[model samples]
Target chain A: MVVTQTNHLAGTEALLERGRDLSTPLLRAVVDRLAPPMDTVAAYHFGWIDAQGRPARSDGGKAVRPALALISAEAAGAPPQAGVPGAVAVELVHNFSLLHDDLMDGDEQRRHRDTVWKVHGPAQAILVGDALFALANEVLLELGTADAGRATRRLTVATRKLIDGQAQDMSFEGRERVTVEECLEMEGNKTGALLACACSIGAVLGGADDATADALETYGYHLGLAFQAVDDLLGIWGEPAETGKQTWSDLRQRKKSLPVCAALAAGGPASEKLAAMLAADAKDGDGEHPGAHEDFSEREFATRAALIEEAGGREWTAREARRQYATALAALDGPEGRAMPESVRAQLTELADFVVERRR
Target chain B: MVVTQTNHLAGTEALLERGRDLSTPLLRAVVDRLAPPMDTVAAYHFGWIDAQGRPARSDGGKAVRPALALISAEAAGAPPQAGVPGAVAVELVHNFSLLHDDLMDGDEQRRHRDTVWKVHGPAQAILVGDALFALANEVLLELGTADAGRATRRLTVATRKLIDGQAQDMSFEGRERVTVEECLEMEGNKTGALLACACSIGAVLGGADDATADALETYGYHLGLAFQAVDDLLGIWGEPAETGKQTWSDLRQRKKSLPVCAALAAGGPASEKLAAMLAADAKDGDGEHPGAHEDFSEREFATRAALIEEAGGREWTAREARRQYATALAALDGPEGRAMPESVRAQLTELADFVVERRR
Candidate 1:
């Protein structure tokens, strides 16, 4: 929000980089163990290499999720590396979903690069996703701790929920009306489940008691909701320079994101106008035409965004994001949360604020 | 084989039915526990229910893999039901791969029913496959046995290889030539690895020592090779009633099956002629046309099979099948196999013979 707040959140990226530095080598080794073709596709997908298999520098990710895992482990009384397996497992599962998501959504670009399916084809994408999924399980099983089985159970349950959410999200695209409650439930499954596991798994590996683990998971769950709420905001309103994509990407795609769902549920003139505009787009302006979603002009997108805001979607989403962030912070201060170190708690709180307050 | 041998192997279906009777309810329970919509797709895919979510009788596969699991566990001294979890896990994995394989290959039918992707769409198919995969791990983890992690690890490794095999299979389709060695490697990865794991995982869950597990896995591995060889034979020659698909499915699709590879590797005039026909199919026929693979006439497929047979491919594959069967039998009788009960040993021998000798 302000210069001081921005500076306070500067450590987020640093923490992420620390996590990448800790985990990437092991992740690389495990992925490289796949069959040669799969390994090549995986490396390419991870941004570790170009399509030719030459070394290439890629952001991989912000490592935000892995940081949560490691920080949760530390909060649970183990060093960050003790959470490495959990970190790797979650990261692999994330990529697995991304690979499939790219294919399913027909997304051509992600993180400023061609999507894996775009580069390697959908068949390769599917198999590579499957391999990554299997590898995630393998890595977790090899944790060699007494809690390894329980941790694995945690990951699998989370994965199922993630897939469930994606399935619902896809199904939503086909429906004329999707309730706000359904949208939130889908978001929780798609986003919250993995984030929740990202913490609880670390807690398990770090030998935390159930109460402490539950507190950390609650923190992550709410943080995930906050993150998705903010992401929905950014998808419609953020500029390309900041969000790393075209303007109004979600509106153009007619994605039933949180803000749009809220606005539609508001059921006023703005909502009616927005629905009519989208319906007309689907009727004549290439919305229903395959590959035509990207054809929306700048003026058309601006109108759509204006409709959502006028429908009260923007205000509702912003409020929900803040509410979720507060819930996350409160989760960290709950009775069982005392198990978390003060430093860890502060870092998590700042991360929650950073997620909701991010400009990109 | 005589009537006596036929009578001996008739119990194979009975064994499969018994295995199905033991594992289906538990398997259904595990699958139905997945989130809504996903549970629906999974139930339909497994033939546990109809697309409408109503209970409907459907062929739930031959249950051969589950029978292998339970029988291997029993041979290692556990009761049949003690292996139910292992059976369920392997069966889930089998269906998982089948779902993805059907999608990847774009097959419209499986087990005389519309394939999951064909009916539910590929996106749903992919997610359901993932859910099943995650469910397999969850079921295995819930076993809470000392060997649970190890068994999960075994399943993960098998899954990875199975994906590798499928990747290789897909890649081979675009190639001009595929060696028999490459074909076998793909077969081993795609088919043999999981079958091997089926036996070994059962052994593990049954508390069998590593030697016993290894012996059983070896038997299944060879049996897998033998099974694939016979399957390749049936793909070219078996009647539609026996295989439950259209005639000449593999040849029409230009699949680089084992027998075709063997024939191509023969390097005779017949091999040259067969190659020429395939090359022409690629050039002149719809081979180059996406979705044109289905345009092949029955007469054309007959000619392709005739060319493969004339090239000595059929004879070579049949001989290889018998050889692999014998090797599998030998594996069952090896010193390491001494831990297997006599009755179990005899049944396994009959199964291997039946794999190679069955007309289908």
Candidate 2:
């Protein structure tokens, strides 16, 4: 099993590398079209340059979305090149959201570097994000094909859902109680919609019929949920060295992540204790203690995390991730998936596996 | 001359009314696609509802862009209905910019109502602006025609220029001097590009060829300059009631608008004095007197306004507006313009005239 997992990781890494190789040049070219300051800021955000405009190689997060786009094109029986525009567009959108989300969430760092808003200021962050979004549509529609129109429509619909998800997430921060169902719906919209778009946009661009694109979208949607579940798990219990975040990072922000919601709904003694603790925290934090997370001791956070696990939050989330992974794989066995090249199917399966197993 | 001016005003009002009538329902329908809080916020921003989510009749800005779009379709020998999608898309982009700009500019009120960021907070402002932008592209691409693809490209390109212009505008606020040429370029991007797109997008949707769209685009580009020049005049000189802003509004904000740039370029004792005063204002406002405009006496603003006018700034700006208005009209007599129906050409001419003359 260990050997098989190692091999799968290697294959997925190769796929992601291929995606970055195919999409980065086009992404850079489009970003270059923006005027000076915005272009400089975008380059800095993309990790191609330092804040002072010097060249630097920093971590630009995993190019998983682009890989999905390329693989979807291949599944549609087209060369990966056919998916390059979709890959570039999806990457542009992903970064656009990052720039804005960093500002909205008051996150100062990303990928171990200061965020655009932190370095350049909030206005540039907003304007650069807007410019990137415009570039995404331009990249797709400039293709001037019917497929390009279809792809653009798909991308925009997914973008709206993504925005809706962000709204829901922000609203969730102020509330102490969020149903497990509400948490799942938000995650599905936030991460799932864009990933679903990335997985199928290239297929649409490559002349895949609606049925084929829908099947690929389904595969991606579940993969995103599984990926997000793992992410929630890491947010609580993962190693800070590997995740590049503090222990209980989500808890520090009082995020109503899937595990927290699940644990709250467990309805046991530990769950009740956890609920009372969080409610008190929320009340104290309301106006009395701004930045209250800073006041918590290491032991207190550990206690809360222990209570969450004891209430079966961690187990439930892990099981949910596995169930989602299985569902994503089952999408490949559907009628449309069966029509795709077997090699493409195998690659997609490996990518899904990588998603749930990723450390960061 | 009085009767002719009255007739022109009436004609333009009718055109604007027609534009609003046609675009409002579809715009509302598309906005409704946004989830609750966003949809509510957007509706409030559009003046369809009040702050408490109660129904209210308020001024939505003049639907000038949509009118231009509908007229462009008519110029292409298509009915106004053919331009409905273009009209809706252009309005969405316009509001998207307004929402973000109000936040960045820190303006509290617009059209006699509180700005979105003022009422809903900055995060919602950013998110809703983003959602509107996504909807704009979605509305166009969902048409699923070759014309829709072409139109989407035009709109996205214009949107990029708009973002670029905004970046330039914000940068200019930090500096004491800006050249007239640079000012024109910024306004051309900020206001002109979207207007140009609006004027041509409907033509594209109505099957106009590149040459025809280009001519109409040129017309709208110059018209936008004229419109902005008139707006700059109102910002400094118009009555507060008519303009829905305080007297010397732009000066209070220290905007390096066209008139200021032109006056600074004019090289005279008055110009020199004006430049020195502005430079000192910038220095004093830097960190020592944040929000220093609140401390400026009415006499000081009046004195500055007098200096700008004495240095030929006001005259030059007014003359520039006329120059652009004439140039816009000349576009209608160009080769492509000559092919448009005569009535359409006349309406475009009247619209350009009205743009230069408007008080608000």
Candidate 3:
């Protein structure tokens, strides 16, 4: 299938902006219900405040999931306003995971800011993350509709999958071998499940039929795989200035992301060499623990990244991303998509394109 | 108002045993749905498995919350089976908090066994806690009824309050002064809210009206306060063998538990002395951090406990427990209680008596 290379970046930006406009206020209002320090900490994590608690406008995120939720509602022939709860719920779930994952993964920075755990502490991180998850369900269940109930079940199931993915990812770090299929499965759980939920929850809340929601979910599932592939690529090759990370970040941390898994599974001389180097790194104790790998030099990370690329990891990942992107777009044209408004389909397609092609 | 001193411990045990019989299978089934390591970790936390993953019948806490739920359902004229979902949901939320609280409080032991974070790692603790929370909502939502939806909302709200209470409890540790009222509020949020929900959520699932649920919830709210008061007394003076904690445990940690707060609020000579000692302890760097107070001697803890007792903290706390217990029992005789079956009311009264009188 020939993929369109149209520059929908501007359109996607507008869509994300619209999503932020719709969801941010409700998100803020919900978070404000958190008691004292949790509220302040959540505000800091959302970039609504400086570390000192002064109000500031910093990058929260792209609001990609919320945008998808809003569009999915439109796809179900409902007004965007009908999907606000879904949008906010998914956004809350997304941020909730971000908070805990930052602590679990020992990530110090996100969106060019110190992580919640880093800024406040690990206890606050755990508590605030939990509070947000509870708020996500509250936002849905408070609607007191049958559709809202259905949407809550969907969001919670997705959350479990997201958590399952995290467990798998953490487990993979200790093992010397991880198959490409396993890596993809982990990514599917960690990132794909929630995205899939976000893509269809709006439709579910808008009182759409199961078929339409399923179709939108399928579209989102593929989009999520594609998004993870791109993210894996950028972890190694993207510019630090754009990505808000250092050079060869994943390689430096020895994360067994998609690219590394694919290349290790390739089984060539360079792949074997890469595997040995990684195994040795794991033996050095730094690989066993997160945030303990700072001893690796830039030159070492460069060498590892180059070996991964030479073993065809980079090329394979890029191709997989494009293939997934094509599949995601094809979902929008299927039988269920026929019922969606043409404008909604166009917006979803634009967003998918932006997801696959963006630098960060 | 005369309080009965009749012994109902035997009947309460039977009731709890029935609750455990009804809820454990379903709880295990739900927890089994967690992926891999999480399932294993949760199994370990629930005391169904040893640290080595072999089966073991460890000391899981008394099934107090589940019993409350089942009895609440009975109060609404529904069979105990009707409250199974509510029972499992509250139990899950309770365990979720325990897993996180152990890590945050740096408590290495629980119920004569190592805590989840102590046995597993902190990441597993956080992840397993999160998974259990998600599972709680899922179990209720999977029932697929409006009552189930309402119960889920109630559970989530209680969960949020539980988290809020934890935040307050943690913040209290670093402060030099904490009021009796503030301590009570923290306990209410941390312990009372979940108990309140447990007491009413079953009625909600059994299609009870707002008046019934409200009355039951009030009963639970006071019962929780009574429970906390007893817990505070035990924290200071209960036998280590029965309580599974060291002697003067709260004082060793320099905790501002209800007893400490009440003693400080008394304003007598002993209260002033106790305040000075605690303030000095706070300045000694141990109070600022949990698990960092090992330097305090046994004699030091004994002296602190004696000071608290001398300041009427112990007597006041015991009286408060009795007062709350009376209030809790009185709820069953209120107007809303008139609709409840006589047997259910008797069972609830029995449970309340056991709660305030239990040694552990």
Candidate 4:
């Protein structure tokens, strides 16, 4: 199989825009079906309205998950429109997770605005998440396709994994340390499962064979891994202005992200230094929990970030992200495997790279 | 149109037992598939295991929701087993709501045991609820039949309404007064929707025609309303030991149940006295929030309950319960209806009576 070089950057961006254009309105319509207060919270969360129920000028987050679903459908030898419901479903599920996640983490800001929980209250946020989840299932079940049941099953399984991952993530917070392997599995469940489902559900919805679905699922799983790796990197090192977070956000939070866990597992001199810094953090009266952000001074956050980097944790994660990205691309190459059309394959490859290399 | 007065109490009990036998293991299995921590929380919530993960002698819930599904399936002309998945799905959904509702309502105990949130904390309770919900949909979608999608849709719509109802219920807490109609609508959405789905889902899975499904849904909706009316009565009037609550539970908690709302709307002497008592409650430095339970002196609680009854609120609620029960039974008597087999009809009528009249 000859893999040719192609600049799918602009094309991929256009496809993402197209996917968002197609799915956002459907998602809005589905969420609008929620009862009064939940509908208002959902619309506000989606940036369609503000807390007072007035129209708001807000551009939503990048529709990455929905883009993957739509693109995968095309790769499955079907029109992208054939996968609109899948796209809508995945996007709704993603937002559902985000809403709950923001609440659990006690996050105040998201997408440059106050989180739903911060604005409406935690109870309302929980209900909104639930409504979105139900809406996702409802949309898929109404697809009128043979794959409807199959896709619904995939989405549900992925959602279960996501919940398990969240549970593990929360459990890890109270503990002093976690193994790298455990952290990896948590990330896979939290992030990878949904992405895998996104691709597989699209193929299933597009009437693709099982083999085709499996290939995209594999691609998506690895892509999700790579995406998290890059996110971990950004959490520690990306410019605050670019990432829309505080300086050294993950370090200040003492989150058990890939790099932090990797450094703790290194068990070397630099690792000792990082551990000491973290130990001091516990006694420093920061009053910040693992799942929440900190009001750390810039110097303290920078020191922790540097200590982890010196332990080579940052480099390890960056390399792993690259490796995962390459593996994802490799999974897409074969006569039987890379059965997707060239244009769609190029688009996926570009999208995969974006996941690995995104600055924000 | 011959509706005979026959004893169906024993027969209804047998059906409930049979439904529990069929659905409990399946529900357990699905919940067990969650990760360990979540599985533990879910098991505890379902009364399968103790908070310590030890074998505890705990009688499970009545399994009324599952029983509705199974019996409805039989009424729709299918074998009970054909509705097992539907039964499991509805039970799981019901428990999911219970788990979240406990958290949102700050309920410390349920079914005479500590709530999942009380035992494991709010975050874990939330995740467990989400997992159960996903598992419910997963179980339905895995059904190797045409009705899988249809059943999933019904459950989703019902779930959405349930969430909406909860949001409304929470919002109602902040207000000084709520209309009886608003209270009834909230009950319909929160409780009626799920029971309605329980009935309609079985009918759909049993391959019932649209007419049959709609009629059964109507029956379940009215049944849910009647159930709530009785529940509200128990909240204020039942023995604490039997009801597993404090003296005058709803009054102490200041829950705007049917009687309270009716009295508030009545604008009679009882209504004025009740309002004055509640106003005194606000000034009593109780710091009453919707979800939090209150500890009131027995005398105070009894006085409040007596005032509500003297206002005729209690009688009004009791009458409404009977009216709704009659309406629910009447829903089953049309020419194209009463499609349920004789045994199932008798069983259903008994169940409806139990809802309206049960002491605990």
DockQ, per model, reads 0.69, 0.81, 0.86, 0.69
Model 3, position A325: C-alpha lDDT score: 90
A129-209: candidate 4 lDDT, tens digit per residue: 988999898898877566887888888888988888888877776556788899889989998999988877778898888
Candidate 1 at A274: error in angstroms?
A: 3.0
| TM-score quality measure for candidate 4 | 0.93
Task: Write one digit per residue (lDDT tens) for candidate 3, span A127-210.
Answer: 999999999999999999999999999999899999999999988887788999999999999998999999999899889988
lDDT of each: 0.82, 0.90, 0.90, 0.81
True-structure lDDT of candidate 1: 0.82
Better of 1 and 3 by TM-score: 3
Residue range A262-318, candidate 2, lDDT tens digits = 999999999999999999988877522124487898898899999999999999999
Looking at model 4, the pairs that clash are: none
- On the 0 to 100 scale, the lDDT of residue B236 in model 3 is 98
Q: What TM-score goes with each of the models?
A: 0.94, 0.97, 0.98, 0.93
Cα lDDT tens digits, model 3, B1-360, are 243555576788899999999999999999999999999999999999999999999888988999999999998889999999999999999999999988888887788888888898899999999999999999999899999998998888899899999999988988889999999999999999999999999999999988999999999999999999999999999998999877887776667899899999999899999999888888878444456678877887889999999999999999999988988888888999877999999888888888888888
lDDT of 1 by residue, B256-338 (tens): 99889988888888899999878776675433212546766788788889989989999999888888888877887789786
Report the TM-score of the second chain of model 3 against its true counterpart: 0.97
Candidate 1 regions exceeding 4 Å error are: A1-3, A52-54, A275-296, B1-3, B50-55, B279-292
| Of 1 and 4, the candidate ranking higher by TM-score | 1
| TM-score (C-alpha) between model 1 and the true structure | 0.94
lDDT of 2 by residue, B1-360 (tens): 122788798899999999999988999999999987999999999999999999988999878999999999998899998999999999999999999988777777788778998898888899999999999998988888889889999999999999999988888888889999999999999999999999999899999999999999999999999999999999899888887777788888888998899999999899999999999988877622125487899999999999999999999999999999889889989999999999999889878877887877
| Per-residue accuracy of model 1 over A28-124 as CA lDDT, tens digit each | 9899898868899999988889877799997576677888888878888899887888888999999999999878877777777788888877778
